[model samples]
Target chain A: MSFLELRGITRDWDGQGGVRDISLSLQRGDFLSILGPSGCGKSTLLRLIAGLEQPQHGTVVIDGRDVTALPPAQRNLSMVFQSYALFPHLNVAENVMFGLKVRRVAARERDRRLSDALKMTGLDGLERRKPAELSGGQRQRVALARAAVAEKPLCLMDEPLSNLDAKLRHSVRRDIRALARNLGLTVVYVTHDQGEAMSLSDTVALMNKGQVEQVGPPSTLYNQPATIFAAQFIGEPPMALVEGPLLGLREGLTVGLRPELIQLSPPEQAHLTARVLDCEFLGSETLVSLDHPAGQGLAVVLPGHASQVPGDSVGVILPEQDRRIFDTHSGRIEKASQQNPAALNRQNTAPRDGQTAPEATEPSFDLNRTTS
Target chain B: MAGPRAIQGPAMTDPLKLERRRRAIHGWLLLSPALAMLTVFALYPSVATFWTSLWSRGTRRNPSEFIGLENYRALLEDPTFWKVVWNNLLYAGVTIPASIAIALIMALWANSRIPARSFIRTAYFTPTVLPMIAAGNLWLFFYTPSFGILNKIGALFGAPSVNWLGQPDTALWAICIVTIWKEAGFFMVFYLAALQTIPPDLKEAAEIEGASRWTYLRRIVLPLLMPTTLFIFVNAMINSVKLIDHLFILTKGGPSDSSKLILYYIWENAFAYFDRPAAAAMTIFVLIVLGLLAAFQFLVLERRTHYQ
Candidate 1:
C-alpha cells in the first residue's frame, strides 16, 4: 500500500463543479501537484485528502490506516491556506507555536521547534511582531512556519503563492521546496499555474472539469499531452490547434502543433500562409502571433528576439510528423501515424481513457519535443 | 471670497509660506462646522450643567445665587441619592456584560450555516428595531401582575403569581432583564458585522493545525472580536445609564423607588421635585464617571485588541 491513497473519490455539489471519482496514490516522500485552470476541482481534490472535505464515496488511506472518516486534525496533516490565515492577534512566535500548544507539547520542545521553523522560513527576527505588522511575504512565511512546526508528514497547499507578488512568489516557492525536501514531506500542492506545478513537483496530475486528464512527470505532461485540453493548457503560448480538414487531414479531427516546432519559411515553400498579427519580445525568445485563415490564433516561438511586423504574410511550416491529431468530438489525442495520417499511432492505445479516469503510470512514448 | 494670502499672487509670494497659510485656513474652515455644532449641543450644555450645579435653586421671591458645590454636598448626604447610585451601578454591571455575552453567542449562531439563517438573524435583531418606548410598553404587558405572560407560564409549573414589577425585590432585576433583551440584539449587529469580516480560511487553517472548534473560538474568533467587543462594551455601558424608557412604562421607579436608576432619579429631581440644581449636580457626576471609565477602557483595551 502506498503512504497515501484516494480510491474512487467523488464529491460533487449539485452534480457538478466538485471533483469526481479521483483515484491517486503517493509514496512517503512524493510531491504531487494537482494542476488545472480555476474551477477545475484541483483544490477540491487537495481538500479531500486533507480531510477538510469528505468524499461522498471513497476510502482515504494514509500511512496504512484507513482515515476516510477521520477529522482533519486526526488525519495528521498540515495545510497552508491561500489567505495565509495567520491569527491577527498573535505575534509570529505564538502563531507558529499554536498547534504545538494545542497538542500539549512541552514548552522546551515547543520553543526549539518554533525557533527552527522560524529560522527556516527567514522569520527569525520578526518573532514578536503581529501578523498585521509583517509584510505580505512575511505573513506568508508565518503560515509556512506554522505548517512546518507541526512536523506532519503530509502537507497540503492551496494556491499559497496566489497572494504574493511575482518576485516574492519565486523566493517563497524556493523556501517551500527547501522545507519540503529537508523534512522529507509528502506534499499535495494544488495550483492553477502550470509553471508552478511543473517546477515544484515530482508528479503533476492535470485536471479538467472534475477529473484527472493525465498524470505523469513534468516532462511527460509537457511533451505527450494525452488530450487536446492538456496540449492546449500545459505550455507557455500553448499548442496551436487548427481544423484537420484545412490541413488536408480528416474533416472531424483537430490538429495540434507546438509553438516552438512550427517553422517560418518562404510563402511559396510552405504548408500554409498566415498573416502576422503581432510579435512579443520575451527576453529569451520571441512569439510571433499569426492569424491563419483556418486557425484563429496561432503563435510560433523563435529563439532570441526575432521581431516581425504585424500584417506581414509568412509561410508557416507545420511539420506533419510533429502534429498531434485529436478527435474533435472527444478532445482526446488520437494515435494517427506520424506522417500522411497513415494510421492511429500504436503508442496511444486506450480510447476509453478519453471519457474516464486515465491510468497515468507515465507515458511510454515521447509525445512532445521542443525544437525552437 | 476673502481667502488667505489674497494680498499677493502666487508667483509674487514665497511659495512655501503661501502654501502653509492656505493649508491652515483650509484646515480651520473644514473644522468650523463640526466644532460649532459640538459647542452648541454638547459643550454648552455640559458647562451650563456644571454652572447650575454650583448655584442654589431659585424661588420667585428670592432670585438664584451661587452657593458653590452646595448641591453636590447635598447629593453626597442624601439616602435616596445613594440608593439610586447603587441601583445604577448594579444596572450597568448586569446589563453590559449580560447583553454583550448574549450578543456574542447569538452572533456566532446566526453567522454559522444553519437552516433559515437569515430568519434567525432577523428574529434576533427584531427587538433592536422597535422603539425603546414601544419595547418598554410591550414588556409592560408581560410584567403585569396576575394576568402577565410570565406569571401565566409560571402557574403551569405550580408556582404562585408573583408581582414581578410591583415588588421591590424583583423590580430592578426585571428592568435589568428587559434592558438586556433590548440591548443584546442591537449589540449583535456589531458582532455579526465583525464576525463576517473574519475570513472562513482562518477556521480551516486552525482545523488543519489540530485545533478543536472550541479552541478556534478561544484563540482566533474571540481575539479578533475584541474590537467589536470593546465598542459594544462602551455602548452597553452608556446604555445602562441611558435606557430608562422602559422604567417609565413598567415600574415608574415605584414601590418606594426600588427600581429607580440614576437617570430616572435625575429626571425626578428636576421635574417632579423641582430641584434643578440637584439634578445638574447628579448629571455632572454621571458625566465625570462615564468620561473617566471610557478613557480608562480605551487606554487599557486598545493595546490588547487587534484592529485589522
Candidate 2:
C-alpha cells in the first residue's frame, strides 16, 4: 500500500477556485512538489493533505489508515507555512521545541531533538533570539527547525522559501533537500517557482486551473509533457508550440519544439524562415525571440550572444527527433501508438522512444525536402 | 557683553559645530510647546497639591497656617480613610483582571468566523460607546433590589428578592459589576485589534503540530497578546482607581461606605466636607502608589512582554 494516499479529493469553495478531484499517492520518503502558478490551488491542495482544510469529498489515508476526518494533530503531520509562522514571542529554542512539548515528550528527549534540528538547519548560537530578532533567512530556518524537531513521518511545506532573496532561496533549498533525505521524511512541497520544484522534487505534480496536468518524475514532466499546458508551463523559455501546418504537417495539431534544439541555418536551407524579434542577454547565453508564422512566443537560446536585430530573417532548424505533436482541440499530446478515438483527427507524432513517448502529429516529414 | 563662549562665534569656521548649534536650537524650539503645556497643566498642579497638603485648611476667621504632616496624620488616624483604602484595593484587585479576561474572551469570540460577526462586534462595543453615567443608570435598573433584572431572574428559581446594592456585602460587588461591564467593552476593542494582527498562519502551524485549540491559545495566543494585555492592564488599573463616575449613579458608596473608592472619598473630602488639605494628602498617596505600579509594569513586566 502507498504510504500516503489521497483519493478523489474535491474542494471547490465557490465552484471556481479550489482543487478538483485530485488523487495522488506517495511512497515513503518521496520529495513530491505540487507546482503551479499563483492562484492555481497548489497551496490549497497542500492544506487539504495536512488536514488544515477539509475536502468536500475525499478519503485521506496515511500509512494505510483513513485520516479523512482527522484533525491536523491526530493526522501526525508537520507543516512549514508560507509565512514561516514562527511564534513571534517565543525564542528560537522554544519555537523549535513547541511541538515536542505539546505532545508531552520528555524534556531530555525534546532537548535532544531541538539541538539536532537547530544544528541541522544551521541555526546554532542563535537559540535565544526571537523570530522578530532574526533576519528573513534565519526566520525561515527557524520554521524549518520547528518542522524538523517534530520528527513526524510526513512534512508539508507551502512556499517556505518564497520570502527569501534569490541567493538565500538557493542555499535554503539545498539545506531542505539534504535535511529531508537525512531524516527520511516524506515531504510534499508546494511552489510556483519551476526552478525550485524541478531541481528539488523527486516527483512533480504540475497543476493548472485547479487540476493536476501531469504527475511524474521531473525529467518526464520536462521531456514528455502530457498536456499542452504542461508542455508550455515547464522549462526555461518554455517549449514552443508551433502550428503544425507551418512545419508541413497536418492542420489542427500543434508542434512543440524545445528552444535549445532549434539550430540557426541559412534561410534557403532552413526548415522554416522567421524574422528575429529581439535578443535578451542572459550572461552566459542569449535568448533570441523569433517572429514565426508557425508559433507564438518562439525563442531560441544561443550560446554566448546572438546579436540579431528586429526584422532580420533568421533560419531555424527543427529536429525530427525532438518534435512533439499536441492536438489543438483537446490540447493533449498525440503519441504514435494507442491513439484514443476521442481525438477529432487522429495522427501520430512519431514517438522517438518509449521512455520519452512524444512525436510529430504528421506521419511523413522528409528531412531531405525540408533541409534543401 | 562678549563672554568666553562668545569668542568662538566669529572666529570659528567649522561647519559641523554650526550645524550642531542649529540642531540644538531646533530641538529646544520643538520641545518648548509641550514643556510649557505640561508645566502649566500637569507639573504645577502636582507640585501645588503636594505643597498645599502640608498646610491647614483656612476658615473665615483664622488665617491658613503651614502645618506639616498634620493632614497626613489625621488621614492615617481616620477609620473611614482606612476603610476606603481597603475598599479601593479590593475594587482594583477584582475589576482589573476580570475586565481584561472578559474583554479578551469577547474579542476572540467576536473575531471568529461566526455569522453576523460585525453585528456581534458592534453589540459588544455598544457599552463602550455609552457614557459611564448612562451605563451606570442602565445597570442600576438591573441591580435594583425589588423589580430589577437580577430579582426577576431569581424569581424564576423561587429565590427571595435580596437587596443587591442596598446591602453592605453585595453593594461593593454590585458596583464592581457595573465598572467591569462599562470597561470590558472598551478594552475589547483594543484586544480585537491585537487579535487581528495575529496572522492566521500561526494558528494553522500550531494545529499541524497536534496542539488542541486550548493549548494553542495558551501557548501562542496569550504570549502574542501580552503587549496589548499590558497596555490594557495599565488602563484597567487606572480606570479602577479613578473611574468613580458610576458610583454616583449606582450605589454612591452606600450602606456605610461599603462601595467607596479612594477617588470618591477624595472628592467627598474636598467638595462635600470642604477639607482641601486632607483631600490633597490623599491624592498624593494615590499618585505615589499608581506611579509605583506603572513603573513596575513598564520596567519589570515590560521586559517579559514581546512587542511586534
Candidate 3:
C-alpha cells in the first residue's frame, strides 16, 4: 500500500482564490515532484499534506490514519523551505536537535543523532557555527540536516533550491535528492524549474490552473503528453503547434510533430517543400524556422555546424510513423487513417456559411526543437 | 636625466583652487547660525557643568567656595542619595523586563495570524501617544484607595481594597506599573518593525522540521529578535531614567520620597533647595554614570554585531 495519500483534496480560498482538487498517493521511498508555473497551487498541495493548511474537502491518509485534521507537529513529516530558514541564534548542532529537544528525547540520543545528521550533510566540524556565519550553500545543508535528524518517513520541499545560484543549485539539488534516497524517505518536492523536476523525481505531476495536467515518469511525460497543456508545459522552448489538414489521414484528425523528428530533405530528395523564414545558431544545434504555405509554421533544429541561412527554400520529410493525430474539435489524439476528409470539411465549413474547404488544400506540418 | 620636466604647473596652485576654497568658506558662513546655537546650547552647558562640579554649595550672587572632591565625598556618604539610587535600580529592575516582555508579546501577536490584530495594536499603542501626565492621572484614578475602578473591581471579587501608592513599599511598584503601561506600547513599535523583517520562510522551515510553535519561538523568533531586544532594552533604560513627567504627576517623589528618581532628586536640589553648585556636581555624577552605562551597552553590541 502507498504510505501517503491525498484523496480528492479540494481547497477553495477566498477573494480571487481558485479551487484545486488534488488526489495522489506516494509509496514508501517514492519521490514526487510537483512541477508548475507560479500560482498553480503546487505549494498548497504540500501544505495540505503537512497539515499547514486544511483542504476544504477530502482527507490526507498517512500510513492508515486520517491525519487531515492533525496539526503539522503530529504529521511526523519534515519540510525544507525555499529560504532554508535555519535558526540564526542556534548553532548548527542545536538547530538539528530542535525537533528532538521538543519531543523530549534523551540528551545523549539527541546529540548522537545531531552528530549523525551533521556528518551526513558534511557539516560535522561546523556544529558550533551560527547560521549567519555559514555560506548560502552551508545554510542549505544545515536545513537539510535539521530535517534529516527527525528520521521521518516523509519529507516535503518547497522550492528549496530557489535561493541558490545556478552553479550551487545544481550541486545542492543532487545532494538533497541523494540524501532523500539514502534515507529511504518519501519526498514531495515542489518547484517551477522543469530541469529540477526532470532530474530528481521518480514521478512528476505537471500542474496547470490548480489541477494536475499529467502525472508520469519524466520520459513518459516528455514523450507522451495527455493534453495540449501538458505537451506545451513539459518541454523546454515549448512544443511548436501546427494546424492544418492531414495529407494521409482521414477527417477530424490533426497531426503533431516534434522539431527534431522532422527531417530536412534535399531539394531533389524533398518529400515536401517549406520556405525557410529564419534560422538561429545555438552552439551545438541550429534551429531553422520553416513556414508551409498551406500548413502551420514549423521549427526544425539542425546540427549547429549546418550553414543554412534565412529565406532559403528547404525540403521537409517525416516518416509515416512519427506523425501524431488529434481530434480537430476536441484536441484529443485520433487514429490517422480512420478519419474522413469530406466529413471533416463539412464540420469545418458548416460554421461558416460562405466558406467551403478550399478545394485544393494541402497539408503542412510544424517542428519545434528543444536541446535538452 | 628626464628630458624636460613638465612646465611649472600653475594648476597645482591655480587661482581656481583659491576660488573653490573661497566657496568652501562661504558654505561654513551659511552654517554659522546652527553651529553657533549648537555650541551655545550643547557644548557650553556641558563644559560649564563639569567646571561647576569643582565648587561647593554656592549662591546665585556671591556665596561660593572651592571644594574639590568634597561634594563627591558628600555624595558617597549621603544615605538619601543611595536610597534614591536604590529606588532607580528597583525601578529599572521592575520596568525593563516587564516592558520588554509586554512589547515582544504585543509585537508577536500583532505580527502573527491572530484575528483583530489591527484593533489590538491600535488599543495598545494609544497610550503611548497620550500625554504622560494624562496617563498618570488616569492610573491615579485606578489606584485610588477606595471607589477607584481597580479597587471597585477588586471589592466585587471579594478582595480587600488596599493603598496602591499611599504606602512606601508599593509606591515605587505603582509607578513602575504606570510607567510600563505608558511606555511598552512605544517600545512595541520598534519590535513590530523588526518582526516584519524576519522571513516567513524561516518559520515555515521550522514547522516542516517538526517543531511546534513554542519551539519555533524559542529557537527562531527570540534569537532573530535579539538585536531589536537589545536596542529596546538600552533605550528603555535610558528613557526610564529621564522620564520624570509621569512621576511628577502620579507620585510626586511619593508619600515618603520612595518614588524619587535621580533626575527628580537633581531637580529638587537645584530648584527647590536653591543649591546650584550641589545640583551641578550631581549633574556631573549622573552624566558619568549614564556615560558608563552607554559604554557598557556599546561593548555588548560590538560583540554581537555579526547577527545583525
Candidate 4:
C-alpha cells in the first residue's frame, strides 16, 4: 500500500465545480504539487487531504488506516496556511511551541524541538518578538517553524510563499524543499505558479476544472503532455501549437512544438516561412513571435540576444523529430506514423540532405523527443 | 554681499508672513463659536462645580461662606456616604466582568453557524435598544414577590417564595443582575464585530495544529479580542455609574439605600435634600475616579495587550 492514499474523493458544495472523484497515492518522503489556476479546486484538494474539509464521498487512507471521518486535529497532519496565520498575541517562541503545548508534550522535549525548528529556519535570535514586529520574510519563516515543530509525518502547504517578494520567494522556496527532504516528510504543496511546481515537486498533478489532467514526474509532464491543455499550460511562453499543415502535417490535426525547437534559418533550407511580429529580450534569452500564413501565431525562443526585429521575414524550420501531433477534435495525441501521412511519403520519396528518414516499422511512435 | 541679501530676504518674506498670519486669524475665527460653546457648557460648569464644593450651603438667613475642605471632611465622616461608595464599588466589581463574560459568550454563539442565527442575535440585542427604565419596569413585574413569575416558578418547584428586591442582601444582587442583562447585549455588539474580524484561517490552523475548540478560544480567540475587551470594559464601567435610570422605576434606591449607586446618591443630595455643596463634592470625586480609571487603562492595561 502507498503510505498515503486518497481514494475517489469528491466534494461539491454549491453544485458548482469542486474537486470531483480525485484519487492520489504518495510514497514516504515524496513531494507532490497540485498546480492549477485560481478557483481550480487545487486548494480544496489540499484541504480534503488535511482533513480541514471532509470529502463528501471518499476515504483518506494514511499508513494503511482509513481516516475519512476524522477531524483535522485527530489526523496528525500539519499545515502552513497561505496567510501565514501566525497568532498575533503570541511571540515567536510561543507560536512555535503552540502545537506541542496543545498535545501536552513534555516541556523539555517541546523546548528541544522548538529550538531545532527555529535554528533550522534561521529564527534563533528573534524568539521574543511578536509576529507584527517581524518583517514579511521573517514571519513566513516563523510560520514554517510552527509547522516544523509539530514533527508530523505529513506536511501540507497552501501557497505559503505567495505573499513574499520575488527575491524572498526564491529563498523561502528552497528552505521549504530542504526542510521536507531533510525531515523525510511527505509534503503536498499547492501553487498556481508552474515554475514553483515544476522545480520543487517530485510529482506534479496538473488540475483543470476539478480533475487531474496529468500526473507524472515534472520532466514527463513537460516533455510528453497528454492533452492540448497540458502542453499549453506547462512551459514559459507555452508550447507553440499550430493547426493544419504548418509543420507539413495533415488537416484536422494540431502540431505542438516548444519555442526552443523552432529555429530561424535560410529560406532554401527551411520548411515554412514566417514574419517576425515582436521580440521580447529577456535577460537570458529572446522570445520572438512569428506569424505564419496557416496558423494564428507561433513563438520561437533563441539563446541570448537574437538580432530580429518586427516585420523581419524569416524562414522557420522544425527539427523533424521535435514535433507533437494531436487530433483537433479530441485533443489527444496521434502517433507520428499513423497520423502524418505527408511526412511518411516525404520520407519514402526523398530523404533530405542532413535529415534521416523516420523508421517506418517502429511499432509505437513516441510523442516526446528526448533531446539530451 | 551678505548684508544686502539678508536685508532683501525679510523684504521678500513679508508677503508670506502676512499670508500665514491672515490664515491663522481665519482659522481661530472659525473655531471661536465652538470654543465659546465648550467654555459655557462643559468647562465653565466643571470649574463652577469645583468652586461650589469649597463653600458651605447658604441658608435664607445667612449668606454663603467659604468652608475649604469642610465638605470633603463631612463626606469622609458620613456613614451613608461610605455605604454608597461600597455599593458602587461592588456594583462595578460584579457587573464589569460578568457583563463582559456573558457578552463574549453571546458573541461566540451569534457568530457561529447555529440555526436562527439572526433571530438569536436580535433577541440578545433587544435589551440594548430598550430604554433602561422600560427594561427595569419589565423586570419589576418578574420580581414582584407573591404574584411574580419567579415566585410562581418557585412554587411549581416546591420552593418557598422569597422576596427578590425587598431584602437588603438580594436587592443589590438583583440590581446587578438587571444591569448585567441590560449592558451585556450592548457590549455583545462590540465583541461580535471583533469576533467577525478574526480570520477564519486562524481557527483552521489551530484545528490542524490539534487544538480543541475550547483551547483555541482560550489561547487564540480570547487573546486576539483583548483590545476589544479593554474598550468594552471602560464603557461598562462608565455605564455602571451613569445608568441609574433603572433605580427610579425598580427599587428607587429604597429599602434603606441598599442599592443606591453614586449618581443616584448625588441626585438625591442636590435635588431632593437641597444640598448643592455635597452634591458638587461628590461630582468632583466621581470625576477624579473616572480620570484615574481612564489613565490606568490607557497607560497600564493597554501596554499589556497586543493591538492589530
Put down candidate 1 lDDT per residue, A1-372, tens digits, no spaces: 589998999999989799888999898999999999999899889889888889999899999999999999999999998888888889999999999999999999999999999889999899999998999999999999999999999999999999889999899899989999999999999999999999999999999889999999998888888887888889888888765655666555677888889998876666666778899999999999987645634789999989788877777777777788876667777776623454322122111213221222222212232110
Q: Rank the candidates by TM-score, best first.
A: 1, 2, 4, 3
Candidate 3: segments with Cα more than 4 A from true spot: A15-19, A104-116, A246-254, A266-278, A291-297, A328-331, A335-372, B1-43, B60-63, B144-147, B151-167, B301-306
lDDT of 3 at A225: 65
- Give the Å shift of residue A95 in candidate 3: 2.6
Report the lDDT tens digits of candidate 1 across residue range B121-239: 99999998999888998998898878899989999998898999999999999999998898899999999999999998889888888889999999899999999999999888888
**Clashes by residue pair, model 2:** A73-B210, A349-A359, A349-A360
Model 1 chain A worst lDDT window (10 residues): A344-353
Predicted structure with the largest DockQ when compared to the true one: 1
Residue runs of model 1 more than 4 Å from their true location after superposition: A246-248, A336-372, B1-20
- TM per candidate: 0.91, 0.91, 0.85, 0.90
Candidate 4 lDDT over B1-308, as tens digits, reads: 12223333354457765565566667777888999999999999999999999999999998789999899999889898889999999999999999999999999999999999999999999999998778999999899898899999999998888898998889999999999998899899999999999999999999998899999999999999999999999898888889678899888886799999899999999999989999999999999999999999999999998898
lDDT of each: 0.85, 0.86, 0.77, 0.85
lDDT of 4 by residue, A1-372 (tens): 588899999998887878989999999889999998888899999999888888889899887878899888877789999999999999999999998999999999999999999999999899999999999999999999998999999899999989999999999999999999888889999999999999999999998878887899999888888777778788887877765344456656677888888887777676666678899999799999987544334788989988797887777776667777777666677786755545532312112222333331222223232110
Clashes of 2: 3
What would the per-residue lDDT of candidate 3 be over residues A1-372, giving only the tens digit for each residue? 889998888886773443366788888899999998888889888888887788888899998788998888788889887777776777888877877887888998898888888888899699889888999999989989988989999889889899889999999988988899889999999999998998999999988767787889998877776655566677654544444342444444455666778888765554455667777788899888776544444678888667666666676765446656555555555655664444332222111123334521433222222101
Q: After superposing candidate 2 on the true structure, give the runs of residues whose Cα lies further than 4 Å from its correct spot.
A: A337-372, B1-17, B155-158
- The alpha-carbon lDDT assigned to residue A184 of candidate 4 equals 87
lDDT of 1 at B131: 90
